[model samples]
Target: MDHLLPLSRVAKLVGTSRHALQEMIRSGTLDTFDGMVELNELLRAFPDTKWEDDAEFRRITEIKERAFGKRVFERALPDKEVLAARLFELGNEYAATKALLMHYSQVLSWLDEKIDEIEEDQNKETRHALHVLRAFIVRHLAEIPPDAAKVQALIAQERILKIMSAHVTIKPSGHEFIVESNDTLLEAALRAGVSLDYGCSNGNCGDCRARLISGEVRKVRAHDYVLSQAEKDSGVILLCSCAAVNDVVIEANVAGASDIHQQQLVVKVKAVEVFNPQVAALHLLAPRSQRLRYLAGQSVRLSAHGASGRYAIASCPCEERHIEIQVLRNADDAFSQLLFSGLNANENIELEGPYGEFVLEDASTRPIIFVAFGVGFAPVKSLIQHAMSLDLAESIDLHWLADEAGYYQNNLCRAWADALDNFTYITHASTTEVETTLANIVNDYPDLHRFDVYAAGTAAQLQLAKRVFLKHGLPAQQWRAGATDA
Candidate 1:
């Protein structure tokens, strides 16, 4: 004869909420017998529920069959309510079973909202009692069956091994990468050539910072970077020090098209025009069949003979065959001297890359604020021209800071401001004036967080500007910075 249990008893037996079981009954998804549900019917309705000791139960039945009992234990499955009552009776002596009973009681109290109604002192007492009971159970369980416990522990270890070998999926791009148990997320990403932003992979810098969107990860090693309390609470982890404990999804600033594999080519210099005594614009032309593919605001390594330098591509990507770079001559630098004096038209130069992540984010529709210092304007010019070509509707404000001699292309910038309805230009000649200008800009647009800020300058200048912008309520995610090559 099948024994029937109440809905609440079924909920307790299955470790599910009573409300869920009630919904099944109300929706006609489950049939009740005399205000109760049969254990078989509940299992049929919730097929995914895990029943403890199922394998042991089957083994016991087989043993009985092999022993002179013809399927004696076949119909021995007890009613959930009766089983639960009998387990509580046994729990008075078995510490492990007692701990399970306490856990279920606390869960039921929480579900009934009774925990919230309890006094803080009573709650603390209950929690402390539960903790002590759990410890006692753990200590006692170790003495029950050493060999069986060892086998169960090995089974748990195998389950954990499977979880640790799971793959990680990067969001927005849906890129999948496997994470070894011993490897950090950044190490796995680098091995797979995933092109994530990173610097000083030892975690001294926060460049490899990413948010854990879903799943679990743990810090596998200590990190030098100091994260704020809010960052920790928000699930931000340094990829260089974090390893996935299970399949995980992370949100990070992934590399786009410009970050793909770089190509090496030898190109001919078409022209080298000296804008002033200190600055020159060098134009180069790649072979018609092998034009360079790159995004605006990316820099390339240019080498001729023994001199090599990293210079930003000042021209827009639309001019594929023609590459323009602005070089600031330095008295002590070999590459600068070579470009200023030793370079000539039609000279062969080796070009290596189109690197850097300073390009404009097309996904943003917010207004833009660009601040450039000295030769840092090179990439800014390329970005602005590209934005103009795209006919982006957002307003653009450009702040150029340099000595009088460095603003050789001031007229061109003014021309852009005059031609484009959405563009605005401002120039500052002194460091103090630049600081004042940036402060005034922030004051003028009290909501600085609504704009995307791009800054290019010396490392010191970029750092100072980032601090100021962040203080003025601009989010770190809304700002990009590029350090000018010395």
Candidate 2:
């Protein structure tokens, strides 16, 4: 079911060479060489095999056939060998993404089957432990380092598998094939000698959105985010939430246009001003000797003691001396409590950033609508300020929304409006004044078709707005979102 088993593994198990595995696929004996046996075929060939009634295996096989147009026979799962062969055969051939996802679902289902089998084994403690460890190792092979000595040590002490053979094939992209243990997709691309474009590794930043051109991946953690069902249907994936389930080929350019390097600055908290009862505005001064460079609307990572969190830089890129961030107390958040109450003004907080791709585009002559929810206003504030500083003559609508008006600071928008000539600020108190969604407001607008919208906030609100935009026939590329969890 899991498509990414090491080829070396299948080679050892079936006594077939990796080349022969590929040859098998080429010669039509196997659909893939990914170290998977067709479920039905395996059952028929070996009636005494243990997996005949395995639900996971059956589920995987069914899903694979239904989703990817691939027939699963004898064990019904293709390991890495089969996957690689298929990728090679389908090189750049267009296939339905939905079909591919179905295949992935099937693979995961099969893995679940294997896990169940191992868990059900009534064996010695050591054997059971080994089984569990092997399952983990097989499922997470991409995360293991290729070091021989370290792997040997793990095999000896942890009862891990000694080796899995894989054909180390690299495409003509001349992309360095770098594998990582516990590395972000962006980090892996970099190590693999690819210039993968990424805004933030934190899921909160949506800079690394792309499609999984091929292969399977596992979804893991995410920040509070939002995306349209249509986007998901279209194969758009967030690299932040994706981990390799197999050798994957994603439709993302490493050297994309958005790649940027910002100068790092270790700054000290010079002052903390409570902008409102709920929101605290933090100002940092470049440590007596260092300065950080970042564009407006970029974000940063902050660490206090040992815990760290991500926040958007509210200051303009030109401001080298002072950096500012507006944070609202999340009474439910441990990090927020520490920042607002426990941290001192002079305390040294670790900072890293000026990373984010939510900036205004160059050819964006269309009117702009900015929608912000809660503290999601941080990046929006920066973009607005930067637009004014650059003196870009553009018509922009700032639609700021919150559950309660009093909980939000109105002065920030008021100041920006007073300073700028073309900016229009509209506030919605979702609690009492306007409980309607932003998409409703966009729909009510006179010239919705003339504006390019950027939305950031709750997943529900963004989804509503996305549907409205798409319903009105806005181009998918024109409506950009910040981050999406769901």
For candidate 1, the TM-score is: 0.47
Candidate 1: stretches off by over 4 Å:
1-259, 432-434
- What C-alpha lDDT values do all the predictions have? 0.69, 0.55
RMSD of each: 24.1, 25.3
lDDT of 2 by residue, 210-245 (tens): 776666555545544566688778877776566554
> What does candidate 1's lDDT look like per residue over 247-332, in tens digits?
57899866665555687888999999889998898989987545565677888999887988888888865453678998888876
Number of clashing pairs, model 2? 28
Q: What are the models' TM-scores?
A: 0.47, 0.44
Candidate 1: residue pairs that collide: none
Candidate with maximal lDDT: 1
Clash numbers, per candidate: 0, 28
Q: Please, what's the RMSD in Å of model 2?
A: 25.3
